[model samples]
Target: MIGFLNIIVIICIIVFALSMLGMVYRVIKGPTLHDRVITLDAFGVTLMGMMSLVSIVLDTTYLLSVIMLIGMIGFIGTVGFAKFLEKGVIIENDRDNNS
Candidate 1:
């Protein structure tokens, strides 16, 4: 049972590494702003997966807190970026536009 889990973990790690390369390619060769955003998000997702894999392999939950923190940070960042693209800023300065 442990051996099977190890194999699965190894496979997941390899997939994550490949995903990182794909995300890097998008980051470097993306021709559009949305593509760059996608790449950045993909990288973040991959990192979270990596953190989970590490948690499994090491048989400890010490890294889970860091993973959750990253998730919250990523969500906030994506929201900020989307708002910036839509309104040219994150924090609006007008009472009328506050929603």
Candidate 2:
């Protein structure tokens, strides 16, 4: 039934929102760089889940592209942060050499 499905979607969206709030707290209260990075990744996942739920509730496919874009951005950001954590820099500069 449409009503049942809507109820389920609403419940799922609420859960996702609550989890996002927790993730936000972690990001704000994190005591280390790795903790913040992990929290950011969780935030991205929460955003993707919330967007998917919205798409479901709206009964439209328009948000699919947005979901994919978010996923790509999230993955890239996680990888970048991991590299930064490992190497201490995401981008290397050689301005001295250029000058």
How would you encode candidate 1's per-residue C-alpha lDDT over 25-87 as one tens digit per residue? 889999987778767877887899998998999999999999999888888888888888788
10 residues in a row with least lDDT, candidate 1: 90-99
Q: Score every model by TM-score.
A: 0.89, 0.86
> Residue 67, candidate 1: how far off, in angstroms?
0.5
Candidate 1 has what TM-score? 0.89
Highest TM-score among the candidates is held by which one? 1
For model 1, which pairs clash? none
Candidate 2 Cα misplacement greater than 4 A, ranges: 92-99
Clashes of 1: 0
- Model 1: CA > 4 A from native: 96-99
Candidate number achieving the greatest lDDT relative to the actual structure: 2
